[model samples]
Target: MARKVTNTRKWIFTCLAWGVALLIFFPILWTILTSFKTEGDAVATPPKFLFFDWTLANYREVQARSDYFSHFMNSVIIALGSTALGLLVAIPAAWAMAFQPGKQTKNVLMWMLSTKMMPAVGVLIPIYILFQRMGLLDSRTGVLIVLMLMNLPIIIWMLYTYFREIPGEILEASRMDGASLWNEIRYVLTPMAVPGIASTMLLNIILAWNEAFWTLNLTTSRAAPLTTFIASYSSPEGLFYAKLSAASTMAIAPILIMGWFSQKQLVRGLTFGAVK
Candidate 1:
């Protein structure tokens, strides 16, 4: 009877979990479905759900309207560039904070985290002016630099957590073997932390890829990413629902595929220190 009750509970929980998952996924599902509908069907008052006349015209029209490849490449470049630059800075900073001792380290970490609590709009004017002066506005380089800076704190925090899980004795053993600091990090620290590092990189790439506000405000035609590509469907007249949905689906597809493939590694890395 106990075993039967446990199984019943498990089934109930499973159904609830599926329910929540579907609820969360409904919007994306709707967007993809809408992408296949004509504009008239897309915004119908009754909101057609699966019974509408589906078509691929929106996708073709979206392609005809803009250079989807250009925005896609821009997103790829900016996301990758920022993640690489952020990792370069974050790894060492996290390493030092994790392995080395300092009186103000905790305070410093709290201060760094505090920056994220503030609204992006608060600093927008200054950053905009700086980018303008530096010739970065509406440029890929400008957006890349901004994303790197924006995600740097999270990157450092993640790496620091990962680095803390690695035993200090391993690093000590490397030093005793006459390994220099660089060699110790390269050989001893990095290999063991691969999962964490990889997950951090992946998460940051997703964050940068989906970042709409900065991408929208900082870029125009030349440097615009997929977020901007989607926004282009909206105009002073009205929203092009079908075309917008098509653009959104295209913009989100790559990152969605990436997250789907990398979820296991991401979950494993995120839970690295939790178990032991």
Candidate 2:
């Protein structure tokens, strides 16, 4: 009787889990469906789910209306550029905090994490003014720097956690072998931490790719990424649901493909230190 009850409970939980997963995925599925519909069918009063005349008109119109390639290139540059910069700065910082702790190290880590809690908009005006004065506004270099700094704390925190899992004795042995600080990190430490670093890179790329507020506020035509590309669809005339959905689909497709492919690496990295 107890074994039967356990089986029943497992089945119930499995169904619940699937239900929640479907609920979360419904919006993306709906968006992809809408992207195939005409503008009228997209925003119909009765909310058309699957019963609509699917058309390629929206995709074609969106392509003709916007330089999709340029926006895609901008997104690739910004996301990759910012993530590369973040890793360079964060790796060493994490190494120090992980291996050579001081009295204030914990305090400093907490302080860094605390910054993430602050509302981004609160500092936007100051950052904008600084950017204007420095000629950073609407420049790829400008947005790259901003995105890198914005995501830096998370990068440091994640790398620090991964580094901590590594035994310090390995670095100590490297030191005994006359491995200079740079060589120790470059050769001994980094290779061991590849999985963690890869995961960190993937996550930071996603964060930078999805960042909308800063991109919208800082960039005009010259430096605008996919976020701005999607935003351009909004107008006082009202939403072009089908076209907007198509643009949205295009903007997100690359990252979605990337995330899907790299999910195993991400999971492996996340679980790097979970076991002994």
Candidate 3:
């Protein structure tokens, strides 16, 4: 009877979980469906769900209207570049904070995190001017740097959290064995922290890929990413519902596929130290 009761509760929770997942995914699903519809059908009063006539016109038109490939490449470059640069800077910072003793380490960590809470708009003007003066505006290098800096705090914090879970004695043992600082981190600490680092890289890539505000404000055409590609569908005249949906679907498809394939790794990394 106890087993039966537990099974019944388990099934109930499972169904509820599925329901919530579907609810969350419905918007993306709807956008994909709408991408295949005509402009009239996309904004139909009754709102077509699955029973509408499908077409690829929107996708074709989106392609012909703009250089989709260029924006896509821009997104790839900025996302990967920022993540790589962030890891380079963050790994050492996290290692220091994790293994080295400091009077104000915790305070420093908190201060880094507090930067994320401040609104981006608060300092946008200064950053914009700086970028302009430095000739970084609308350049891939500029966007990459901005994204790297923006996500650096999170990367450092995550790496610090994961590093804290590692046994400090192992690092001590390496040092006692005459391993240089570079070799100690490169050979020992990094190998053990692969899962944490992998997850951080994936998360930061997604964040940079989806960043719209800075990208939109800073870029025109030369360095515009997929986010800009999607935004182009909007005009003062009105929204091109079908074309916009098509653009959005194309923009998000790559990331969604990546997340799907890497879900296990992401989950494992997130729960890396939770159990022990």
Model 1, residue 249: distance off in Å is 1.0
* Residue range 44-90, candidate 1, lDDT tens digits: 98999999898999888777778777888999999999999999998
Candidate 3 residue 25 Cα shift, in angstroms, is: 2.0
lDDT of each: 0.86, 0.86, 0.86
lDDT of 3 by residue, 1-276 (tens): 999999999999999999999999999999999999998899998999988889999989888878777888999999999999999999989989989949999899889888887899998999999999999999999999998998888888878877887998998999899999999978998799998788788877887999988899889899999887677656624558888888889889989987876675455444433332
Clashing pairs in 2: none
- Off by more than 4 A, model 1: 40-55, 236-239, 260-276
Q: Residue 249's C-alpha lDDT in candidate 3? A: 93
Give per-model TM-scores.
0.84, 0.83, 0.83
**Separate clash counts for every candidate:** 0, 0, 0
Q: Candidate 2: which stretches are off by over 4 Å?
A: 1-4, 44-48, 51-53, 177-183, 236-239, 257-276
Worst 10 residues of 2 by lDDT: 267-276
**Model 1, C-alpha of 165: deviation from truth (Å):** 0.8
Candidate 1 yields a Cα-based lDDT of: 0.86
